[model samples]
Target: MKKPTMTQTLLFILVIGIGLFYALKYGNKAKKDIAEFESKKETNTTTKEIIELKYFGEIDLNKTEEYIDVLTNINGNEISIDLNIIEETISKKTIQPTINFLENLHEIEKIAHKQVLSDFKNGNIVKDYIEHHIGEFNDDDLKSLGIKTTDSPKERKQKFLNKIYLKRIGFYPEEWDSLAIFDFTISRDLTQYLIVLSFDSNGKFVDIYTES
Candidate 1:
């Protein structure tokens, strides 16, 4: 064979150099892609494990759709917690804490009830209710309750407040229906109201409001 020229040798070296550069570049890119894929897989696996372990008996994935229905007994009353999970992915950070909360709902219910009562007495819930529905009470109803229609609004309001006593109708959990985790139905004898309490993922009270 004829000896290769210097020009041919230089061209061969150039081609080899270019090929090696691309090979190294593509090889690094592939390795980076694989690493990222593996990291995502590990993260997903960890999340799945947490959900499975933390919510083992609290929820059944097959039976759950938009929310998890947890039946609980409180003071001999069969109450259910409809924990919301609509448009949510089952994960520890999102759903597990709420499940944990519902697990000890019997105790939490007491705390929530106490807080609601305290708020009702100190807050504007009663005032607002009296303001909104006082007109609904006719002369006969007022007389029966010893409230005079001719009395000043303040006097009437005080009399109404005296007659008002909260009787808890039932505990309704409809986290799926609204932001509130627990909806405590309170009957003021003349009217019914809902004490809607919302909690964070960690079972801390976030908000409380009254609705009729």
Candidate 2:
């Protein structure tokens, strides 16, 4: 075999170096494009569907999983909340509603236990009669004051329904059932709330009574 001259070797080396540089640049660009394509594909694909009183739409449930990942950060297990009803309303509110309102309740309880206790005791709630009269609830029964259990057959659902409403609102008068339902509204100092006060197919609240 003939040994290559100095000039020939130098030119060959330069060509190989240029080829490697282009290969790396092209590989990186291809990777970026693949990432972008995957993100858009995930967003467009639908894996879930739900209906709400006001709005309903298909959602790509696991679409953003890649983008919004938690690294060694376990905040909490995913709670199965009715996202269809609350998602739009929560985004519109200055602060996310239900969770934020619950946070406020915690804060109030922290600062003034007496006031929180007084307010809670006097909290606006559904009348016991209404709750007991709800016919029947699938789950959730009033065990006692400020206590409810979601693991029961619960034939008489009226008072149970009322108690659940009361738990969400705080306290309500006995005559609240007689008055127009439009007057029923709940609020916390920190967050805006929208209580649908909805009923199930059997005229039961079905635990879908509260929204924020």
Top lDDT hit: 1
Runs in model 2 deviating more than 4 A are 1-4, 52-86, 89-212
What are the Cα lDDT values of the candidates?
0.59, 0.33
Q: Give the lowest summed-lDDT range of ten residues in model 1.
A: 165-174
User: Which 10 successive residues of model 2 have the least lDDT summed?
Assistant: 65-74
Instruction: Please name the candidate that would achieve the greatest TM-score relative to the true structure.
Output: 1
lDDT by residue for model 1 (55-128), tens: 22544432345644555557665555544545434444444455566566567667766676566578876567
- Cα RMSD of predicted structure 2: 16.7
Q: Please write out the lDDT profile of model 2 over residues 111-196, one tens digit for every residue.
A: 32232223334543333323332333222322432234543434333333333221122211112221111112221332243333
| lDDT value for model 1 | 0.59
RMSD of each: 9.2, 16.7
